[model samples]
Target: MMKNWLAAGAIALTAGMTTTVAQAQSTMIPGENVGLATGAPLPEGIYAINTFIYRSQDTAAADTAINIPILVWATPFVPFGGRIEFVVAPPTVFTFSRVAGGRDTSINVGTFVGGLWAFDLGGNVGVSFLFGSYLNELNAGRGGGLNILASNTYRAGAAISYTGDGYNLTANLTYQFYDTPGRFDGPNGIPAFFGPVGISDALNIDLTATKKFGKFEIGAVGYGTVNLDPNILVFPAGLGVAPGRLGRGGRFALGGLIGYDFGPFSVQAYVARDVVTTGPRGVESTDGFFRIVAPLYTPAAAPAPMPAPLVRKY
Candidate 1:
């Protein structure tokens, strides 16, 4: 039940506690795939997991909130001698700024869907690969002014893990490609200091090393993220505005996680800060995360113990 719980995928940026003028340039948010043995394969069953990833991006920049619910199913049949799992997650986004007495707004976002294939390579080592898309429905007339979530993103990634001796060492890598870098759901797109802006491609990697002792678990976790291309100003596709070189910047964070298993349910939590910052102001803030994984259904064991009764020799 403690095997590869969740893999890697890109969603959006963080809405920290402070207020600043920071618009997300990269699509992949760091620390989204921390804790858990995210690379290993789960046994054949159906499970539900809620992992909250908070970002303190750009220290007092405006803040956003998101609630994402995920459902996963490990299929009974294996393809190419590997386990195949399917996932679907849709998130509700809430954006609010702490200026002018705090303005609040809400909008419809995308649903994340992924198809992952995981394999166990003996020695309790597992590897998996996945492909997915974030189909964002950021239509107009929703409201105005918010650059917190990236729309129309495609993601691909891989994960590997070694779960042995009640310990887990795992890492997951996700690369996100954004189609509309300077686009949004509101009538106003990308609240820029000047004009519209865009971020090209980005990559994120999450690492975890943990050991379990009895019902308690402890681990160290971290993540590093970078934009693959230069940040630039954007315009409509039809409007031919040749993009120019802007700049490249990224961030790195480190933290720790602890968890406790009670019967068939487990909960984990962690907090991390941007230990290294190289981009916008207020990008140096702390993020705390919490997660819960529980089983919703399970396949019946084979052969059972004879549904009726066994005859005894009298």
Candidate 2:
């Protein structure tokens, strides 16, 4: 009789879990295109909008993960051609596996860092530094979501682009270093299952191109990453099966973007698909997704004309 009662209660709890989330196998898409416009200096002002969804995984498996991030940013340009950018994103909700898989399937919910800076070098080239950190507390599981909310992550890279004659091309290369292995422990403080066994530094390369056609623009962008440490690729974290092991070597993705520029404010929608994988034995994922970013730039006054060019000097 007691067993029957407990099973009935579990059924009721499972049925109610649907209210927490919609589907378990959610698609992994790209983040919205924030500032793909001319890439030129804009008037100092604040920009806010729905940055779009970042689909990290999309497998037919019973479990899946998805992230919905909202961004608010402020850009201030100094007279010396330098720019200060401040940004913050809240929630960054992440759900692992499926709701049907039960509450035990869920892990943590927290905020992530999405801020960076651009120091101009006259033309369309600039050296930029970026810093991103994850702050998530283990809500229902062990390991406290260590990787989701450990110390902050910092990355520095250089970028160059040409925005001339209604054409734009940009390329960037960055290296990522982690402060910790982002591990997790069980209730007794022993290591957990999903936590990182070992982690090594990595490198990334990104490229993008766009062409303007009146008010509408079309283009594509892609990125690839390289794994530096072999141990990090083949230790206890190895995907169990030999095929899944190669999935750690590296990865690449590409997609299309469409935009409409209207004066100071422009709206851009992007649809990118993962075409290839850099992994060895085909243990990687090839899930494709979509994203959108509408940046509303504030209006600025025209620069003052050079007054009577140095008449006294002559």
Q: What lDDT is obtained when candidate 1 is compared to the true structure?
A: 0.61
TM-score per candidate, in order?
Answer: 0.79, 0.63
What candidate 2 gets wrong by more than 4 Å, as runs, is 1-42, 54-80, 91-110, 113-115, 120-127, 135-151, 187-196, 233-248, 262-265, 280-314
User: Would you list the C-alpha lDDT of every candidate in the order shown?
Assistant: 0.61, 0.40
Give per-residue CA lDDT, model 1, range 101-190, as digits (tens).
666665545667777787878898888887777665353311123332444667788888888887878888877776655443223532
Q: What's the CA error at residue 208 for candidate 1, in Å?
A: 0.4
**Residue pairs that clash (backbone atoms under 3 angstroms), model 2:** 28-55, 29-55, 63-97, 64-97, 255-272
Candidate RMSDs in order: 5.7, 13.5
